[model samples]
Target: MADNNNTLRTGDVVMYKNQYRATVSEVNADAGTVKITFDTGGASTVPVSDVKKA
Candidate 1:
């Protein structure tokens, strides 16, 4: 919904809220959420609006 994540997909690296660098591991367009793995090894589901292709 008007986010840079429109082109996002698995394997794409993104910046979380303009900070943490994370990799997109899964996308849930229907839920408007994305599963991301941080370079630090932690993972979480974030709203699509929280990330953008880096």
Candidate 2:
């Protein structure tokens, strides 16, 4: 689950789905989602519950 104090922001580094580390590109706080770009060159929008600071 997404931590209340772990509010994400653009340019922050984070782990996605406990699978890969990725850079946060955008945050939709109202929607409870974030768009991230992986180090391997891919991007995706995921729920805040699936991400955490790296």
Cα-based lDDT at residue 46, candidate 2:
94
lDDT of candidates 1 onward, in order:
0.91, 0.91
* Clashing pairs in model 2, backbone N/Cα/C closer than 3 A: none
lDDT of 2 by residue, 1-54 (tens): 354678898999999988899999999988989999999998999998899999
Prediction-by-prediction clash tally: 0, 0
Off by over 4 Å in 1: 1-5
In model 1, the worst 10-residue window by lDDT is: 1-10
